[model samples]
Target: MVSSFHVDARALALVGSHATCETEHVPETRRRVVAVVGPTAAGKTALSVALCQRIGGEVVNGDAVQLFRGMDIGSAKAEPAERAGVPHHLLDVLDVTQEANVAEFQRDARAAIDAVRSRGATPVLVGGSSLYVRAVLDPLDFPGTDPAVRARWSAELESRGPEALHAVLEERDPQAAAQILPSNGRRIVRALEVVELTGRPFTAAMPGYRSVYDDLVMIGLSVPRDVLDARIEKRVAQMWADGFVEEVRTLRAQGLERSMTASRALGYQQVLAYLRGEIGEHEAIAQTTAGTRKFARRQERMFRKDPRISWLDVDDHALVERAVALASSA
Candidate 1:
């Protein structure tokens, strides 16, 4: 959670403030790094495209899953038509066999932002995950990884399972453990590794709410919890209808199960379990829906802690226009 002290007064004022129709063109000198953030299935992709069209902007992918190629349908990646021709950077850049590194993403996303700015366009960073977004926007530095130390934790995880490791994390850094799910062994192992390598609590490595960019505008989409849950169910249903299972099957053949990050993705993980005869297809879908809802709640909790975010109702009819006004005025 980002501290309230980092909130930008000018940015927060955009929450309910109105802007005239003529306020379409944001001066290049005042162009801000606009971020569209919220829980999953909250219409962030649509909002991002609308903002880009309204403000001569390009998108820089902040969602870690969207960075991988061939994982499109499950990741909810925007189709080319959905993007509406707005140039998107960092989408489909990595193979499923590779891990998604936050530090690498931070470097690549910042470069994309600079490149977009050089082209006289605002870089709209769009994603649902809080850490990935902050990695690009905030001055957060990740602790170095030790392969041997990481291996030790990984071996322990395989033997004792994620819950045991999470118990350990809870004892060492309760704050970090509370934020990460017990089922997520990869993140748990990484947090434990950080704790050991830094000789401090994992939470201690996380910085306060301080952004690297001065001209930044964060727009959050607020949805009722029930509505968001319904949306997640609908989304998971649509993914199945869109051959999500087939997509996972194809990726699995290409060594997706060996990849630490890609294999653990939301729908992919449950689907993999089903494919391996661990569960039925119906159970897979149910788990995906339930897991997505849980993840969305976590996303909302994390975003709500950031005071700089100016939130608007997801159902707002004038969302794009208002966001434009907010960005232009900021």
Candidate 2:
């Protein structure tokens, strides 16, 4: 099923707090950072624009792919016309050739929030990327790396297979090993590096991830499972109709295959498989839809883990009214 943001306002207020410093200003106060989160095709972009219209706020791109240039159609990125004159940050800020990560996203997003507040406008973060959500709203407790530790793991990954090294972690820290997939060379290596430096499993040491926003308001959008699945399929179809294959071809022609991470994103990955004749057009569409559905499920799980987000099971609901009320009270 699609995500159900059944979390009430009271639950949100009670659960969204820790003993950390009160960095989140009061709603209607200066520098308010409101977050809009949900699964794919859940209408977050529309809600964000609505919030901006009512609250004098600006939109910040929190999705991972929307950062890259020429990555528009496949990313399901908010378009210039769809944005409706809202000032957006972090969209099209990187070339497909440049690698971007969570740290960079956090830094850029925080700066955008600060800048919007300086201009006397509220800052509203909008997108489905939950890691980005946690990085800014609730940061995980990942310590700065020791270069020696990182180097050690890096060297090992080069010489030894990831499985052999992951076996080493499975002995010392099974929890960390389980979390790091064998296919995920980067995260697996980082997990082992953290283990070497701190002598503690990375998974075991993750309890310190805390929310930085005080009195923060969150509105999550959810649709029924079947409805969301249909929406995902429809979106994939529309993307193809809107020239998604051409986008992939252009990126490939520009040598963007070197940036495998960007190319592996939802539609692009399936398109590449089709390009290589590994899959036909029908299979490619099915794979992309299935992958998107899976990613949406992951997004739902991610949002549910954050007690701060009160899920809204949207149907024929009046979101603008709810959003306006939240903004006014905030």
Candidate 3:
């Protein structure tokens, strides 16, 4: 019994190795790369920590929300204690005001994975953001950002509301529009700005979103929708209890704008409204839960579209065992 492998179109182009390369290349596979992806509050952190401990792998973050500092509870980021001494990369490395893109994340994550290999350990990327995970694992592209164009688009967004600008994006870059929510004004505007500046659809210019990483084992943790919804609600409660409001308050004190991605995170947005007396805390919780559920659905859809991912349930032992099996086989 042997595992067969074949080169895909991208790999054929990259390596120029289309001489009838059959599904028979597995025995000579290079190194191993594994990713753990799932929706928010679906035990990504616990599974990741267990995998890291079991496999002596270094963890790299793929979730966009995990990059911002002071976002512990809401991001469901691993606490220092909860990390169980596993070295993690790319989490809590940026301020709420800083911008992080897939291209940058890909570069950084690749370097981190290389470092882990150098240390004779496996590389495990963990997150729910399918786009970011794919950006790292596959050789996909990220559209370049033109500061000037983005500035202009942002001004338009500020004056016209995200819906109006999203309509323009829908006209120019329908694919990007479909992927990025109109409610995600920053991303919507950025996609449209890239298309306008480069005279290309944003997808065509994405340099980091498509790739052919043969050694990668991308695992996705998918919970039942109802179960995930309940988890989201419970996590929101935990987030508030863990001082998520004060975290946003500190960020606000430092002059975080609603436009910043960190400020725009699911729960933070509604909490900001509450802090500003625009809504009550109860309303903030309810709104945040709803927003998280919506985001989770989108995340699930993104992962579903990727055939490379192996879906798994979030059982404690199963998650650890699957990751271990993938890494060991790699």
Compare the candidates by lDDT and give the number of the best one: 1
Cα error, candidate 2, residue 61 (Å): 0.8
For residues 135-179, write the lDDT of model 2, one tens digit per residue: 777656565677777778867876886677878878888877755
lDDT of 1 at 66: 84
Instruction: List ranges where model 3 is wrong by over 4 Å.
Output: 1-31, 205-212
Which is the better candidate, 1 or 2, if ranked by TM-score? 1
lDDT of 1 by residue, 161-210 (tens): 98999999999999999999888889999999999998888878677887
| Clash pairs, model 1 backbone | none
Choose 1 or 2, whichever is better by lDDT.
1
The lDDT of model 2 is 0.72
The parts of candidate 2 lying over 4 Å away from their true place are 1-30, 144-189, 204-210
Model 3 lDDT tens row, 4-79? 1111232112111112312223222225677888788888888877766666566777788777767777788877
Q: Give the clash total for candidate 1.
A: 0
- Give me the candidate number with maximum TM-score: 1
The C-alpha TM-scores of every prediction are 0.92, 0.80, 0.85
**lDDT scores in order:** 0.84, 0.72, 0.73
Question: After best superposition, candidate 2 residue 268: deviation in angstroms?
Answer: 1.5
